[model samples]
Target: MRKTAHRMVWDIFLVNMIIITGMPGAGKDEFVKVAKSMGFLDVHMGNTVKKYAYENNIKIDDTNIGKFASDERKKYGMDIWAKRTSKYILDEDITIVDGLRNYEELEYFKNNYDDIIVIAIFANEEQRFERIIKRNREDDIKSYNEMKSRDDRELTWGIGKVISLADYMIVNNKSLEEYKSDVKSLLKTIIDSRPKIREKLGL
Candidate 1:
């Protein structure tokens, strides 16, 4: 079937999406913030999981939420989170998806979207732990042991494989200002290099 005029226009203008995958506290949130400032909409997979748990009356703790996500993956396949989160994605020029934890999820988006780029943010374990402790979100790991356990759970879900397969990798081990600068510059380059986006932005 031929495409509608609106569909053709969307295809012409939108740059599609960027997938952000990183371990907990690897600055995925910061990356989203920068992307948002650059006019990209975002859908966070973790928030999707948490919202599902909330509506189901499941206690919103790390363990319960993790188990729910894992069980869903086991039942529906490894891309379950991606399936759920995709509902929240908007038809924007560029959408940044955060909290991608596994290879199947990556493949789900790649198979569905026309243009997708996966970016992995990396920080050494020590740095990640320090940042997690400093940030102290309610669901964050409270100790090194808990962080280790969380890492193991994520690895079991194939996060390491996804990270290894990322199209771009950003090391977020420096000062926040410097890291933000690097992220901004890299995102700008990615956006500017897109032919349609370049024309849209008058570049």
Candidate 2:
């Protein structure tokens, strides 16, 4: 009976992968935070880029970070970030990857994992701008024009397509508590449904 239980646990771990996609300031970070609290191993693609920047002594500002991401994509491939991030996922039961920007990244996860789910968090332009202002991250855009420009750049990377194609969508235009509640509920559903999902997928 102990052996059977151990095998079931391993089987579940082998099939759990959640990939998160959203635009900047859309609460992707918050969602990943909640997932981490629930014991999911969180991987951020932006962190991978930031780490690369730090390692190479590149300026970690918004323009330099964006340029570095673009240059790496052009140099390595469109899925360069995903490739780098995947290496860090080591034997985690439920791995939640944040910062999926394009279809290529999505496809990389899909091709590699048998059971993969994508969740996109969204907020209105005004709401996202407000969050950006409130958070005031060093890499965040300062003006409306800058925000729009960043949006255009991410859209050009096919973030819109990934957002539209997500298995689940969370609109985060409300209170933080409400958003956290919604995320908790969604995570519960995903965790509870994993076994049935694996069965259906024959994993």
Q: Candidate 2 on 1-203: residue-level lDDT in tens?
A: 01223433232224368888888899988998888777777888999999998998998777788888999999999999997887676543567899999999988877765578999999999999988889998777889898898899899888999999999999998899999999989988887777754343334
User: What does candidate 1's lDDT look like per residue over 1-203, in tens digits?
Assistant: 11334444332223377899989889999999988877778889999999988998898777888899999899999999997887676554567899999888888788766679999999999999999999887677889999999999999999999999998999998999899999999988887778755554445
Residue 164 deviation, candidate 2, in Å?
Answer: 1.2
TM-score of each: 0.89, 0.87
Candidate number achieving the greatest lDDT relative to the actual structure: 1
- Show the lowest summed lDDT stretch of 10 residues, model 1: 1-10
